[model samples]
Target: MTSLKLVIIFATLVAVSLAGVVRRDATDDDDDSGEEKHHGPAFLEGLDAATKDKFKAIFRDHSLKGDAKDAALLKLATSVLTPEKLAEFKTHQVEFKKKREQWKADYDAKYAKLSPNAKKAADEIKGLWEKDGMDRAAKKAKKEEILKSLTEAERKEVQDLFPHRGKKPSRN
Candidate 1:
């Protein structure tokens, strides 16, 4: 639909405008200025300046997504990543995956106890987030509508449990 295309276009524009400021460290330049530099993750901290820039560019690229993105990153890492660092990073990755799985399981347990209406609203909000071509305003409106359909107690519980609730998204 024309509206869907327009929404995607608008979202892209907003992203472009924010891109420069979103990542101060993603840029290739070495800043000698007094301002504090954004330190990369612990694993990447061991890499040299030029190597860091190369990896950063690969990571910043929008054209690479999903498996393609992972492959690109891995190829770059293969070149310069030390064996010890690779083992350390892999350990961290496994730990992260486990933590995420546990969190999802805990949330699912909580979700199972929710009222039918609450579950419906939660599903609608999750769908809004997952749906392609959904602009922020459209998602916000949809979420508000879903929340309004619930009773006061239901609304409070839903809002309290929401992943996005009470947090401003990170600019970095």
Candidate 2:
């Protein structure tokens, strides 16, 4: 009977020790996982208040809620721009405008040197080509809108070029 009591006591002690060890291990694992939950600093450091608000508004519209969204937008804004960056962009735009104007002047001077009949023909061709391009774009947009309103069969009946379904079929 004494031997049996001794065995039972020893088993109990072992089980208790194991349970304590298991609990300690679980606590340690919890701590390690908790470290990953730490949040970092915000990204909107240098922009003006108005711009930051605008950025936030855009972020909200894109369904980017919370600090993470704000941080991402602020980081992008900082990386791509500053007052200096804006100034640089404007300067490049001005330079490009000047270059385009110079090219146009040079082209006009060359056109003036051409024979009158040649210049007239060139102008006529340019006007006709521009008009054709504009007409094509307008027709394309109209066709797309019409197609959106159509059943597939009706769309298929519309000619690809002029999109006039009533026109006489062209001979290839």
The number of the candidate with the highest lDDT is: 1
Query: Which ranges in model 1 have alpha carbons more than 4 Å from their true place?
Result: 1-36, 46-76, 163-169
Cα-lDDT of candidate 1: 0.75
User: Candidate 1, clashing residue pairs?
Assistant: none
lDDT (10s digit) by residue, model 2, range 1-172: 9999999999999999999999887656467433332211233344456655665576555445345664565465556667675555346446656865676676666566655444544454345434534565675565466556655544443322122335866536
TM values, all candidates = 0.58, 0.30
**What is the lDDT, from 0 to 100, of the residue 37 in candidate 2?**
25
lDDT string for model 1 (1-172, tens) is 9999999999999998789666755654776653445466566765678888887897787667556876777777777789977766667556656876787787788788888888888888887877768777998998998899899988876776656446976766
Query: What lDDT is reached at residue 157 by model 1?
Result: 64
Query: Among all windows of ten consecutive residues in candidate 2, which has the lowest summed lDDT?
Result: 34-43
The worst-scoring run of ten residues by lDDT in candidate 1 lies at 32-41
